[model samples]
Target: MAETLSAPALPSVYRQLLDAIDIGIHVINHEGKSIIYNRKMSEIEDMEKEDVLHKNIMDIFLFNKEEESRLLQALNHGEVHHNAKQVYFNFKGQEITTINDTFPLIYEGKRIGAVEIAKDITRLERLTRENARDKQDARFTFDQIIGDSNAIREVVENARRATRTTSSVLISGETGTGKELFAQSIHNGSERASKPFISQNCAALPDSLIEGILFGSVKGAFTGAADHPGLFEQADGGTLMLDEINSLSAPLQAKLLRALQEKSIRRIGDTKNRSVDVRIIATINEDPAVSLEKNRLREDLYYRLSVVSILVPPLRQRKEDIPVLANHFVNKYNKRFQLNVPGIAKGVQQLFQEYDWPGNVRELEHMVEGAMNLIYYDERIDYTHLPVHVRNKFPSYNDISHAPEALVVPNAPPTKPLQEYMEEVEKVYIEQILKRHSGNVTQAADELGLSRQSLQYRLRKYRLNIRHS
Candidate 1:
């Protein structure tokens, strides 16, 4: 007689097959007790076989309503649920979000049990929401931050040291001082550069929304809420830049301090804690001492977040950097406007240095951009090209002319590439039309007898920046 495999050996083969599947397999008897919970199901629920096997589903999991538990519904009602999403908490207090297909099991024409095939989407749900949000691209690095002043160089050096470790950083500076720029640079230089570099402006959103955004939320946690991961979870293994952190309310500050200390966060209305690994870089637009004294920022939270503090000097303090920043913006707009302007005029440079820039580096950039909108190709930005407000600051600006002298070469021909020559001619012609129409693109396009969009495309193609006269 041939040897035969025993009946006990058959269940082992079936169990191995069930465990091999990626989807969670859960089987429950008519009494709603879990009869078979495969390895995948155990992993999905973060529960062990010993804990779930032979236990009632209700005893292991909490459902908002009996109807919400798909497995139980299948066993009790002989119903089949397909591609249904269920968000519920397990006994261990962990929130489990899954998409499930459940069906009642029938044997000999009698409803006996229920079987559920589940796809765990806890992480995917969070990632989907995170990707949907508008995120700024972290493109700046230490090399891109243009400033030669000692004040700025010292701040940059401290920020560079921050990248070497996973310490919390607090960057304090006035508004428009490029605090976010330094934050992005440090993130790019850190080991977590490859990971998500998430930024949230604490001042932009109200406290109610900010809490959910930073710590995440579960379905039914609030009206019109769904399962989602917070910034901490989304920025796991990376950096989280909180801009204007002092704007956060005091109660939120206490909560933030807890998350930093524990390295874990509890979702809104969640009972369980989720671990996260995130490097935080927070910024404030006032002195830390003033913010604390005014009760705007919590001292305890400040201490926690300021493992490394960096104070960026304002534009007025770092006046030496004004010329370099202006030049950088000029080069940037030169490509955008398709102009070949070499540099700014000396008169304009003198006024820029003399003025107390309340808006800091951002004001300088805007001034450069405004001037670029008014100039022609091959012309340096001059005093007359400066915006009216800048000119008004220096009443005698016209008297101080700094025009670029023509380099007269004996017997040298004015030879250039045909493409360059054509571009220059087209740019000047469009500019003249725009000037005639007071920079109205529609009127300019109609006067030029081209479609509005067509003329607009040409404007961009030739890098024209038209300002209304």
Candidate 2:
């Protein structure tokens, strides 16, 4: 007979499983008493299990109120909270930040208790603050942008006009469309150019921490807190480039709107408001209208931030600029790599213009850099020197003429596993569909027989950074 598993051993197995998890786990009973606290939880909170076990939550944690404790909320109100950011002090007077998913435990249709899974991000918050404090100067100027197409020129003019005033500017475009470049150019041309230019990606942190990072905090605001200046204070009389502004939470948007209107901001838990003279330049990866419809952005804040709006056109719509950008990249890499490569082959140049360039100018630049790295004896970059992804984008890739010595074998069998192979094909197919629809996600989703959200998930999953129509 095989070895039998006993029922009593089940509890031990469950305990082991919980301890093995990477995230913190804390469970409480109906009386708000700690029942199970995993090893990860102890590690995250920097406390021992014995310190928490058999203790009331109120006795162990420093929550402001019973309702403020997510575990208590689940036990009392049967409410579920997902990806909620919580900032609170532990019994040891240390402040902690966590993204929590708390759910009520129900038995026989009656509330019993609650369990919470928490991810610690305190170090991330500290690092973000440190990075913001060490931000560098704006290097790119208006003259550095390569494109001369009417599409680019119009936006350049619009951005230039934005520099004349301190009005908030909203720049919208696809990823790698040079939104930050335009932002830097605008700041360098403005009166504040001599002052600081600090940039932050709003999506980099959760709302709870971003608030502190943006507005700062006093020493007594939270446990382990200190006197710190925020981005607004650091960027006083200068420019603050907030990239991916749509990623900010609703409460943050409201706070930001107030700050913009009042021309002042208050530190977290501080009563006094400090005035700032920072010019705001924000960027969004997609159209603002779509963001509003999706409830990802606030309309009032959009109007406030878009006082001077600029939309940078995608690469496909401005194909005429590809040759100039390509040549610029070639020249750039030549100087850096210390190589004397002549230029891109005529056929490769034609290919670059024909390709959809879902990743835009950034993609073109990377492709050139990749090809330059591969060249040794070649006098010029050619079709054969291109990255595999670029070549695979064309169905007639094999038909293109490459240097005779460039090939030993053709149509080699794929070395990757089947799952990887299928994913590659699927990614390329989705990209082609998006390109065909001119990056209209809804239309592409329809053609692909998928819901818009599902297609969007796949786009992110595959990292297919494409422009929206």
Candidate 3:
């Protein structure tokens, strides 16, 4: 025999692949006995492979109790489940709430077994509780905002002034503009600094769950809801930040107003009212006027919540602060990544100033962090280390230095005034861009290297109605 080769066994290959996966994988035969349980599954369930081998998956994960048998249901009825939530207890009494996607395993036109891919939410639940504890003792204060621009200082002044009183403060800004930082700083600087300071995103939870999270829940509120104290109670005598408050439904708005007026809340499925001495700090991504115009937020609630309003200016409006922020991020990441990075490259600083950060300061931080990851022994961060997305925001260095300015209109109407002719060229330029982008102001603005607000103002001046949607 000149040469001999053998392919890996199918079972061995599958076992290796399943073991490599990060999420738990479980399989059960038609009789509900475990057939393919991987190492990740064992680790997620806090069990051993030997314990789960040949045992029924329901028996192992659900502790010998058949409460809502997903595996059996799939195998017997050829059913499928996608992102279905389930809670079960292991033999060691560890409760795991998982989102599972179960599908029937078919062979030759017959259901052979069922397979399930699950992500254990046990750690997520723990982190959420720990987050509540962390909020009780926040770290970031007003001094940590790291910007000296008048735009930033104006908002900080308003926030600091509002901190003295327990009046409801509304801090409005886009994503990653450090709205939560302002909220926490206000709390820390307030008289209620010693008490708990809880913050929750109103948009994170569904309407049904949102109510219970804010006002709390009784034993029989819905289904599995235990006697839990809501965020309002947790932040009693302190601050409760309801971020993205515009996302709350109309009914919830009424309830929130009632709670604010009475300084009390009634838990779901409970009649007794609980009084809470909590300061409210609300954050909205959009302008309050726009929100009120669209009826996305209630009028009464807005008046109550915006007793002291603070609008954090977007990063683009205050590009002068980019140098300070960039240096701050470099120092922060140098210690984090254990590098001796000196500072940002001058070329990178220019690009950062030129680019419009749609995601605001968070995007800048992420870009810096990404650049740091790519850099190893370099003393200074440079343009080459910039992420592809950030690099793609503008033209290449060669293009910017050499690319010819595009012609607006080839036919020069010599009969008109120079200013009028220039206006015509501008109109034609805007028209073409709007048409190319299907009348999207944001995209057109980005392509033209102008801010969205500036583009909108020009559209009004030119009487162009570019449909944003």
Candidate 4:
């Protein structure tokens, strides 16, 4: 069994315990004599603790510092110095970096000695610089963008031009307008193309989470919070895309603006700011002006972020790109579903052009995906193969030129399931056709290209009152 230590050994044991810690620590009395120099300080200074003991801290640390010694300041003023990063050369002339907190030790409101706690980050600083030098390849290039419409071309040209500079970019468009696609293309075409192109949706998380993710969090910042690097640090020397920027609350917008201006971030629990060379590219679904008026976004932040603004034209405005986008998706899904769909029927192409796609390119992709799933090998996607909701957009005469309201779908994807949307459309179309034929079931069936029996079954299925003429 180990022998128990005597009371006289407690002081030595405490001193050894202090020396075992990785950080440098020391205390100074009223006469500026070292009173609590530890082994870590001796190692950091490359001097023996015995030699520094009973000596003024100023005497032991000789440096041509631009700022006054914080320790001396605290000792004289009987004040406190929080975590401030200080840089200096140690006794061996090696550069030392640390964040220190110093305070005058007081008893009964009377100033006594001063204690200093330091966290040495010299090695971490060096490693960070070295890691930043490593190149990260971007995931997107301009060549991958498929649109050639003049509206899309103009936006693309401006985006490309914006990439040549380091100014922040703001992209705005309706849902499914591919804002992130443009952001990725610009990043890939920029001088920082080889650097990481990280993306995050600002609205995806809560306020506290967004703050912690963007600015990072230090150990003990909160419960279960570790010293984790944020997206800003992770995207150093690269681009970081913040999607749905308007979703960030006003207070968070201010914090983001500060980070943009300072190019540095202080973690949730950290005291010192860490510099990062990250380029920002923010995207929002709403117009900046409108968002500002609604107080959903900060005005100053909007101007600071929209240094180079790019507006992605919605699908309706650039309808000319629909065919190409459709074909591209068709080919993509062909390989995915292992089906050899020869091509789209001309009627289907016409129907696609006639329909005003409110869900934009994303909706089109889903439409094609839905159609492809129904078609077998060697089958051509025709108007009938389209989803019922899409087919319902065409009027009784199969003409939508005069039926603007029928072609108008919501900007967002249908909230209900696809089958429900189809049922509603089928019921409405059957009712419209019945009314068009003056309740003549046979004429309506002929016009719909369905057998009379099928028509009767559909009318019964939808509980529609029909007449036979």
TM-score against truth, every candidate: 0.58, 0.57, 0.57, 0.56
Can you tell me which runs of candidate 4 are displaced by over 4 Å?
1-138, 395-469
Give lDDT tens digits, candidate 1, residues 1-469: 9668799789988989999989999999988888999999999999999888897676577442458788878877888989999877775546688999999999998889999999999999878757655465576899988899999898889889988999999999998999999999999998999998999999999999999999999999999999999999999999999999999999999999999999999999889999999999999999999999999999899999999999999999999999899989986786567554667877778888899999898888998898889987556788888778777878887787632233222232369776676666667778877887889876786555443445656887978887521
Show the lowest summed lDDT stretch of 10 residues, model 4: 399-408
lDDT of each prediction vs. the true structure? 0.84, 0.85, 0.82, 0.79
Error of 3 at 95 (Å): 37
Best by TM-score: 1
**Global lDDT of model 2:** 0.85
Candidate 1 vs candidate 4, lDDT winner: 1
Question: Cα deviation of 421 in candidate 1 (Å)?
Answer: 23
Best by lDDT: 2
Off by over 4 Å in 1: 1-135, 402-469
Number of clashes recorded per candidate: 0, 0, 0, 0
Better of 3 and 4 by lDDT: 3
- CA RMSD of all predictions: 25.0, 24.0, 22.5, 31.3
Candidate ranking (lDDT, best to worst): 2, 1, 3, 4
lDDT of 4 by residue, 143-179 (tens): 7777889998898888889978999999999899888
